[model samples]
Target: MRYSREHKLETHARIVKKASVRLREKGAHGIGVADLMKDAGLTHGGFYAHFDSREALVIEAFAHAMDRSTERWRKLAEQTPPQKRLASIVNSYLTPVHRDDPGHGCAVPTLGAEIARESPKTRKAFAAKLEQMIDMLAEQIPDVPRKAARKQAMAILSTMMGALVMARIAGSSDFSDDILGAGREAVLGRATSPKAGKPRARKAAPSAPH
Candidate 1:
């Protein structure tokens, strides 16, 4: 018995989806072809039939994982109040829950450093997906200009990622809290402050003119 093309495609997608979760749970280097195949309920021999190579699967899994993360954030942004969304996002991203549960968390702070050493194709896909995630984030900020929104999104993401990384490196709850708390305060403060992103207009010297 042979599977139809549609069935094959569906199976392939299933494999990739499962692989994405596993990749997020364990960094790309932490997983292997056999382990992913078993987790996906497929034989190792079938891996090549679905993807050209592990590199291909890595790219697909990276994109899929990022999509899941951003979609989760988008849902939260939609339901949460606009004024509080940035803080909420920052708090959630820097929590111990997120740090302990890499399987369901943001890939940027999880495997980003590892991905830097990966194939160029994987890096390219990651760059594009990150931009898409930023765009999704920008959508949640209706009051800001497109460029400003994107810049804000980038800043938020950068802070969140950096905070998470530092917390992990610090290896202590107190340090983790301090790192996350400081980052949250800085990001949310700037996000909520009236003068954020605006340049102060310099007053002219009227006496000098006279």
Candidate 2:
């Protein structure tokens, strides 16, 4: 039986949501299309009805996961004081709970390396979402200029993602916890410092006349 337009849209969203989780849990290209469809409660043959290709599904899923992450950060920023917003976000992001649960956490640390090998369209989609995340981060920076805030956001994201990846790779829980703690401190310290996001001023040129 054919489904109505709304039903089809809902089904499509379900597939993307399931794909988003599984992609983080088992890297892009780790799980087969059939498995993703099965987890979505649909048959393999029906996959094309919702997405043109696996790459398309991946791009959509990546965007969905990033959107969830951004929304969560936005809420955290709204509830937090302007001065402490970055610290709050960093603490929330680097916790052991988030570290242990890759399936439901942010996609960047989990899927970023794998995405580098993907098609241009997929990488472009990821890049766009990443910029949105940076913008959200920039908003939390206290006194920095816009350009400096964006730069700081990039550095903060890089540090957080790297630390999480290392934490996951470590053999022991203590090491993982250490990594998370260190990362939280480092990011929060930079974020809260008065000079953290300030751009360096250029030196004045020597006077032309004696």
Residue-pair clashes per candidate, as listed?
0, 0
TM per candidate comes to 0.82, 0.89
Q: Give the range where candidate 2 is weakest over 10 consecutive residues by summed lDDT.
A: 201-210
Which digits, one per residue and each the tens of the lDDT, describe model 1 over residues 1-210?
Answer: 798999998998898898887988778888899999999998899899889999999899888888887877777777678876655556556665565566767788888988899888888899999999889777776689999999988987788788878877775466665675567667776422111112324211111000
Q: Which digits, one per residue and each the tens of the lDDT, describe model 2 over residues 56-123?
A: 99999999999999999988879878998887788778765677778999999999999899889889
Distance (Å) between predicted and true CA of 151, model 2? 0.4
175 Cα displacement, candidate 2 (Å)? 1.3
Residue runs of model 1 more than 4 Å from their true location after superposition: 190-210
* lDDT for 33 (candidate 1): 98
What's the C-alpha lDDT at position 37 in model 2? Answer: 98
